[model samples]
Target: MSRFTSICLGFILMMVSCDERDSNPTFSHDIAKIIYHNCSPCHRPNQIGHFNLLTYTDVKTNANKILYTVKNRLMPPWPADPHYTSFVGEKVLTEKEVGLIETWVKQSCPVGDSSQIPALPTFPIGSMLGTPDLHIPVKPIRLQGNYTDRFLVIKVPFEVPRDSFVSMVEFVPGNTKVVHHVNGDLVRFEFDKKKDVYDGSLVDNLVWDSTIRLVYKKIGLLHDDGSYPTLARSVVNYLPGVIAQKYPEGIGGWKVNRKSAFVLADIHYGPTVDDVWDSSYINIFYAKSIPKRPLQEFQLGTLGVSSIVPPLIIAPDKISTYHSSCTITNDISILTINPHMHLLGKSFWAYALTPEHDTIRLIKIPHWDFNWQNFYTFKKMLKIPAGSTIYIEGVFDNTRDNPYNPNNPPKEVHDNNGSMRTTDEMFQFIITYLPYEEGDENISLE
Candidate 1:
């Protein structure tokens, strides 16, 4: 081999290496652009999300955290099933984009050209787009000096000249930062016009004098030991961002009789503030008439997993999977699948197994957020064959490390008796489906 030949080969190899290094996109430009477009809205200043990613510094500092959240599909929280209809403002990233961010972070988050930086996205003042049909507000309530969870019901009087239907409803938080969640229900009659309805039966004066009791008197207890004694906490309508669900098209148009009354109760958790006053409210959007289809929910769980009864402690920080099967007796079109769990819930997934034993993935929440738990409505109706077996699985974490742990020193929780006591955990898979028939249409459960 001659010296000239050796030099030429060496030069060629150096050029190739330089090209590869230069083509490696930096996190500052390519990666940061994705985060700013998708995350900065709520995650920015004074928003509900915990952190901000408004600038290059913010993205650079939390590069690894960003990578983790995006990889897990937890940071840009869109909970609906991807197989369903697509939604506006979805935070889902393409496979290539996710790969780019992951690879960029591994390369030490290199800084690309500053001039190539994209413009930052502008977020709305609130989650809603325009003025709502009806805005219901709750008087500012003072919080205890310590972390406390309180449920309040604010009655909103609606005078329906005739029967009407609701298409879309949004809970506009008077104080978004402090207001944790909101649920609204439409009742036929006015049980109590004014009995301090907003205070979740906490005030003795209101409960004793008011004709309306917090507990649901109609729905009989499903359990034997009385674990779920009263329907005091049952929310007909609820909105929790990232989990705030929209009813199937036919579902939202339920009839509200003339002069009928509806109640909006909000659930709030104040962790940091001890003596802060917070106000929360909701706005409902109604249509003049009902839709063509009707919506119904199928509850699979709340059944005892064991014969041994009362105070079923599943324990925190531990993984416990519960199994339940439902057979579709009649042909039905499913609009949404909502998996419910309390503070100790870590993840919930549901799928359908054909009579032949083939598996169909329904919905999967690998990392669950109790604060953002919601009804995941499919964009399109999911048709299940009659006699199909629907399977559900839920995992719980009761450890002290979980931020949502309600217990001071976490203990074992279980599903015992009929009631869901403080020391117990409840598992349920609530699905919204429409009866299959001709002229059957979609409904919305907003």
Candidate 2:
């Protein structure tokens, strides 16, 4: 063979080998390593996540679902701007890692070798450890197989010799698989007939009626007596993905008077009611000694809006804005901020401007997810100067492209009150902070 021909043939063979290697379906250690590091924290046994992804078979069975969720940036849901600051336990997938999973799924999800699998990551069983100071469980109730929202009120009873304070709290779902989301409220008034309260309350009449089926509905129920609604003077909410937040020093604890009655109800939403959920519980943590600080949550904007036109409509390729503001009177430490919106919400950004016009970016959720929203807690205390103005802006999309749009024809909606309807939208911003003084109370903008 001629020297030139031999050289060209050898080069072509090398090129073919490289292309074959790149296209191969073989799993790399890198792929398994990333999953173990990022997903196993909550996706393991006895955890809040619905499924376990510890083994190769576990990942293979749910391969396509995993890819779709990750590519869409839905699962391991962390809502923060990656460019600004990264959190300690943030769950974001890199481009290369996402591509690797997509390629592996297309290549038949090959399990290269059992021995090559890395050890699953470990996470501490927080708040769940040790016996709870108090546990409140709801009565067992059968969810009717109809499309409706159910509101239930359960009253929890506790006997306190003196005023007590709460430091930490946890809401442990009896059936994490079925409970969509639960909200906790502190009610000082006690009812003699709890069942009647559940049946006749305004919330029950509005949510639990039998008219609508699959579209939207709510159920109302309360907790039982042996378990008192876990009471805390300072901390008002406790749920998974919510962290242990403390107030600034010298703020002191919340006041829970002795012999005072409390009610803790769970607002349960069943997208599709297939199973019967009877026993759900929430645990409350109390400190042996009261701390120098107390946590307080302030509602910055108006609770209801009055608009002549529907405020929340967004047409195809069109943009709409929702604005709300809150004013601060005294210097304080902001522990966390939560932004709430209905299905049409797209993006949210919030900032605080001092009286001098200097601004501080509190938080920004670039892509909003209604299902996984929570109070974004700051790692360190954020001190806001006294007399600051807080501003929030949220954008919504109402066109057909928006999968969450409630309306079909896309009509213009404006009403006197800022209540959400076919054509209207509502806006709200909640901030949790501690007043600078020991006995300083919250001053609301509304």
Candidate 3:
């Protein structure tokens, strides 16, 4: 054949191959696995997802919506920027995968071979950390349909047969819709200090009064002899998309007294229009052995060890940025970090600089979504040198243009002395770590 004729045939073949490739992609073979693995975990029954994405019909119905969100990087809400640093269980889709979904949706969501569709994955029923040694039920809370947020201090009392070492404390929200977040502390009473661990009233409404002593007394947190019991802060926490934080065996576990209680220092439930009841619970997993290196934690900014550089105040109709930093006095292996902000949050970032001037990227959320705050765990332990300085920057948009701004005219907002109210602003970076060990840098947190 002549050179021009040969070139014409090659071009024809290439065009045919491209057409075949576009036509062959289908829902059963191409899209099921992605949704099953990434979206279904939250989109199924009794989850935070608004609707089910479990079947072919469901995908077909929402194909356009799904395509739009993936294109905009909205759905499967992972706030951590993968480019800055990666964490375990990241749900980000690749550019290629996003293109495939786009093409499939554009082609009318073909179901080429229904038989080839992968089976729906099975998820744990109650607890994500497997069977628990003890299950402590949180007292059920009733909420009115007045569209007002409720903050409650609750005590979940329990008595184990004997003092036991616990590796993990898992908080499972019974009402995913209304339950916003939880911060729990462990209260251990001396075996002989109190006759009954269950004698106190279970709950107290924080809105009525927030006086420390009165709240404690109203909730029956004091012992029979009118003395304070041992309290461990941040034993368990819960947010919308957060998986329970479980470290490797013997890394971080706390001992529970025979007579103990799990005090939810404050549990926030979002405003609802319909009256509902929430019955969240806690699961305790016994440790195989005592913790070899107990986990320690500290925070930067807004009532933490470090203070916000320009203070956390945000003026109405304005955008502002604030910074905070803290120097590490001791070498530590950092496990997990949680960046916290409220409705007005725009962006967040954190990093550490060593004395040698080497920069260590910790986490960066270029666009902040208040609904999906998470405790981001590192894939492996991150070692910060003793002289390293960790810095954090947060941006808040209080202008009317900001859709999430709670105020219509965008009134002034600030961290009201580390207030828990959603409308009030807060900038905090909480780090959980352990003193550095010989091979700590090589340890995997997964």
Q: Which predicted model would earn the best TM-score?
A: 3
Tens-digit lDDT string for candidate 1 (235-303): 345443443444544454555544333454335543645466666555556654576665666677775
| Alpha-carbon deviation at 370 in model 2, angstroms | 1.5
Candidate 3 residues 277-384, lDDT tens each? 998999999999988888888999987999898988899998899999999999999999989898899999999999999999999999999878888899999999
Model 3 segments beyond 4 Å from truth? Answer: 1-23, 208-214, 224-227
Model 2 lDDT per residue over 8-107, tens place: 9999999998666546645445457767877766677755577987878788888899889888877667776755544334567877677777888888
Candidate 1 accuracy as TM-score: 0.71
For candidate 2, the TM-score is: 0.70
Query: Which window of 10 residues has the lowest lDDT sum in candidate 3?
Result: 207-216
Give me the runs in candidate 2 sitting further than 4 Å from their true place.
Answer: 1-29, 41-51, 85-89, 94-113, 116-130, 147-157, 189-253, 259-266, 304-319, 410-425, 436-446
What is the Cα root-mean-square deviation between model 3 and the actual structure? 4.3
Candidate 1: minimum summed lDDT over ten consecutive residues — where?
202-211
Q: How accurate is candidate 3 locally (lDDT)?
A: 0.88
